[model samples]
Structure formats: structure tokens, C-alpha cells
Target: MPKRIMEGKVVSNACDKTVTVLVERRVTDPLYKKVVRRSAKYAAHDPQNICQLGDQVEIQECPRVSKRKSWVVISGGTGKPSEKRIRAGQDAAVEAVDTGKIQPKKAKKADEETVAEKTDDKK
Candidate 1:
């Protein structure tokens, strides 16, 4: 079969040497008379690790690499556009002021003590 190519945005480049790209396509439903959007995630090989999250990318399907990485990044170009997911512990700061229901967890007292000791050691 001929090679298959799809255009999409780079969802993430956090993996050690791989980039996660998400390709979106629009298709019209014959029965419903509506257009639907669909997206598929692919892990692309990124040896340079230069592609940043949100960067648009083009991928070509090839023999399965490992398990989920069947696509290879052809080139790194400007993304015309899109949520992969945030890292496990790092999340964006909330935009609005806290309503008290939610507060940044106070650093535990033990952490504070450690900070104090570190400061003392530096002096």
C-alpha cells in the first residue's frame, strides 16, 4: 500500500525521545447530515526533542514501532492551530482568585523546617 500521511498538532514533546501528536479530521455523517470531528493520537519519533507542545506536525504511518508509535514525524513546521494532557504533578495556575473552597495546599510544617535548616546552613 502507499504511504499514509496526516497533518496534526503536536500534543506533547515531554517523552524522553518521542513526541505525541494528535491528528484531527472532519467527516460528514451521511445519515445525520452533520459534520463530526475525530482525532487520533500518535507517538512520533523525535530524536532532537525540539518539538514543543502545541506545535503543528505532519506524520506518516509506517510499520508499528514498539506498540503505539506507528507514525514518524516527517518535519517540524509551524502548527496552524490544541489538550494533550499536563504532566502528572504540574498543572496550570488557576486564573481566578481562590474562593476559599480551593487553596494551594500549604507546605507541610516539616517542609518549612527543612527550608529553615537549609537557609541556616547557607549562612
Candidate 2:
């Protein structure tokens, strides 16, 4: 039989040579006959440390590499282009925020001013 393959997002890549992938699928409920989304996490071997958080990847069944890792990251699958663009955009945003290039807008305290006016009127 051919090895099983699954597509999922890399939720965690903190472990050395291993990443956690969250595979989500829709299944019809047996009793209700309604389609329900379900997800399972699998530990896949990532030898190159290439996968990052939120990276979508393809995992293939292989001989057990560890107690929990029986799958290997085969490819980026359908997530190659989007992943690179997202990561690049995120990195740029982070740098901009960190260097004070993009300052977040602060909300004016109009509510506070109104409360102060009410307190003054009562006094």
C-alpha cells in the first residue's frame, strides 16, 4: 500500500528536527448528517528547520523517526507562494514596528472628557 499523505499547517516548530502540524478536515456527523470540521495534530520530522509557525506543509507517512514522529515533511505542497509572501510581509512589518517606522494610531480620550464634564456639572 502507498504511504498516506496529509496537508496541514505548521503550528509549532520549536522542537529540534520536528514540527507539529495541525491537519483539519470536514466530516459528516453520523447522527446529525451535518458537516463538522475536525482537526488533529501530528508530529512531523523537519530536518532542515525550514518550516516556521503558520507554514503549510505536506507530511508523508514514514518509518517512525521518534516515539511520536512517524511522518516527514515532504513539501510545502500548495502553500509555497503564499507562505513566502506572508513571512516576508510579516518580517517587514515587524521591523517597521520595532524601529518606530510605523506608529500605531492612538485613540483620543473623548469618553474621559465627557465624564469629566458630567462630574463638573454635578459639582
Candidate 3:
């Protein structure tokens, strides 16, 4: 039998020589017949420790390297963050601002007075 190959995004690379890949697939619901996305996480071996978070990677089935790792990374080690990761970071920043965890820089006093005067003039 041929080894199974799958492409996914690396969600984590915190382990020494392993990265967690999140593989998503579309499946039709048996009862609703609606297509839904399903995802699974696989621990893949990365001997060189090159894979980074949000990196797209191809992993192939191989003999178990550890208790939960049976896939080996075959290709793809782009260090750039993916769009999803960037959006997540933006969301986190927004949340921090909303919760007062991060204070946004204040506008200059002159700028604030001008904006206030404009609003007053419109009234």
C-alpha cells in the first residue's frame, strides 16, 4: 500500500522535533446532507525543526516516531505567518483594547480640541 500524504497548516511547533498539523476536510453530513468542515490534528516529525507556526506543510505517513507521532514532514517550511494567523493576532489586539489590557495612544491635545470644535459647530 502507498503511504498516505496530506497537506495541512502547522498550528504548533513547540515540541523539540515535532509539529502539530491541522488538516481540514469537507464532509457531507449524513443526516443533514450539508457540507461541513472537519479538522484533525496530527503530530508530524520535523527533524530539522524548520517548521514554524502557521506554515503550510506536507506530511506523509511513516513508522511511528513516538507515541502519537506517525507522520513525517515531507516538504514546506515557509517561515511567514499565514493570513489566518495574522487575522488572529489582529483579533487579539482588538480584544486587548476592549478589555483595557492595552491602552491605545492618545491623540494630541490640539487635535482633540479641533475635533471637539467641529462637532460643536455641527450642532
lDDT of 1 by residue, 64-88 (tens): 8777787888776334232332332
Evaluate all candidate structures by whole-model CA lDDT and list the values in order: 0.74, 0.88, 0.92
Model 3, 119: alpha-carbon shift in Å?
3.8
**Tens digit per residue, CA lDDT, model 3, 1-123:** 999999899999999999999999999999999999999999999999999998988899999999999999998876865556578999999999999999878879999899999999999
TM per prediction: 0.58, 0.64, 0.67
lDDT of 1 at 33: 81
- Tell me the spans in candidate 3 whose CA falls farther than 4 Å from its real position: 81-123
Residue 83 in candidate 3, Cα distance off native in Å? 14
Q: lDDT score of model 2?
A: 0.88
lDDT by residue (5-82, candidate 2, tens digit) is 998888888889899999999999999999999999999998888887887788999999989999999987343434
Q: Which segments of model 2 are wrong by more than 4 Å?
A: 77-123
Preferred candidate (lDDT higher): 1 or 2: 2
lDDT of 3: 0.92
Candidate 1 lDDT: 0.74
**Model 2, residue 87: C-alpha shift (Å):** 16
Candidate ordering by TM-score (highest first): 3, 2, 1
